[model samples]
Target: MSCEECCQRRGLGGRMIPVPGEVAAGCGLAWKTAPEAREELVAALEADGVPVEAMTVIELLEFR
Candidate 1:
């Protein structure tokens, strides 16, 4: 999605960032944010009538 669309839909202090090649092989963007904020973020998007049919939920493993 475009930055404008993401900015208008996202609730938290999130921004569209370049997708990692390991995540996907294309010139695409994804929203970067803290995992704890998922609920509020989703709620806000729904409240704003943003269609989230294409949204994917992925758990990233933290390397210590």
Candidate 2:
């Protein structure tokens, strides 16, 4: 169960993304998700006892 896998399973507009240059949390990957789902996502991750560096709301332009 990789980080990417967990996010994918949520099906809440989550995707694997590179960690922004300004932040470092041992891993080079970050989870990108919709702002609306942030609270739910945070609760889930925390409940699972996942090691998270930080939760940030990054404004990204979704390209369809």
Candidate 3:
């Protein structure tokens, strides 16, 4: 997330759930979401002109 204020600006509030492993890895913060939602998320970001190349999609090994 950009900042605590970012969520409020985007009206995302509680929707921006935190990812577990990211904080442990010192990655600051990440969005918690299901693997199946990847495509829709990517499409939404792209549609909003958010450059998504820097977005990393990590699939849990067990899910694979």
Candidate 4:
């Protein structure tokens, strides 16, 4: 299953947070849910040569 689907199964609100760079695609997870795996995601992007300046959680009222 896709990451989005997997996250959804875990009851994570769906929202996409920007990755470090355009080199890698972004994700589909709400900031709240995304924050849970923020460290791992940032690490992966950084390791892929993407610029990881910051990794933070933003509370979004809407999914779009």
Candidate 5:
């Protein structure tokens, strides 16, 4: 997927994972990335012609 490819190309920290339960509804998946990467990521996604619905930043107790 584009998310995975974007991270790999830029060496960003993230992965494709199941969307958190609290979110209303979605494709049941999301690309988890560092909050700091949002801006660059948005640009990359736009360049890649990916339509982004929403992006949220939250603290996770652990991510690996």
Candidate 6:
């Protein structure tokens, strides 16, 4: 899936959520190349037996 796709899957977009840094690994990332690397990370984690799930995205545009 694309980076944006993955982010969307995790409920993140132009939104924010209150969570710890440990969950940062699943934030989909803020890199321009995230789409390229994300799938790999997911695959690697899955191969390593790591559980990954999507997170909730909270709209925070108003807070800005």
| Candidate-wise lDDT, in order | 0.62, 0.71, 0.48, 0.47, 0.77, 0.43
> Which tens-of-lDDT digit does each residue in 1-64 have in candidate 1?
5433654655367667677556677867777666677777677766666655344556655576
Q: Is candidate 4 or candidate 6 better by lDDT?
A: 4
What does candidate 5's lDDT look like per residue over 3-60, in tens digits? Answer: 7786678777788878875543655778888888898888888877777767888665
Give the alpha carbon lDDT tens digit for every residue of 1-64 in model 2: 3556666666556778778755665558778777788788877777667777777876777788
RMSD of each: 4.6, 2.8, 6.7, 8.1, 2.2, 10.4
TM-score to native of every candidate shown: 0.55, 0.69, 0.43, 0.40, 0.75, 0.32
Deviating ranges (above 4 Å) for candidate 6: 1-33, 55-64
After best superposition, candidate 6 residue 57: deviation in angstroms? 10
Question: Which residues of candidate 4, in runs, are more than 4 Å off?
Answer: 1-33
Cα RMSD, model 6:
10.4
lDDT of each residue in 1-64, candidate 6, tens digit only: 3434554555443322344345455344432223345566566545555455653333223345
Candidate 5 wrong stretches, greater than 4 Å: none
TM-score winner, 2 or 5:
5
Better of 4 and 5 by lDDT: 5
- Indicate whether candidate 3 or candidate 5 has the larger TM-score: 5
Model 3, position 22, has a per-residue lDDT of 31
Deviation (Å) of 35 in candidate 5: 0.7
lDDT agreement of model 3 with the native: 0.48
- Stretches of model 2 off by over 4 angstroms after superposition: 22-27
Compose the digit string of candidate 3's lDDT tens values, residues 1-64: 4432443455443344344463454444555455666666655555556543244556533352
Lowest lDDT 10-residue stretch of candidate 5: 20-29
Model 1 segments more than 4 A misplaced: 1-11, 53-64
User: What shift in Å separates residue 11 of candidate 1 from its native position after superposition?
Assistant: 6.0
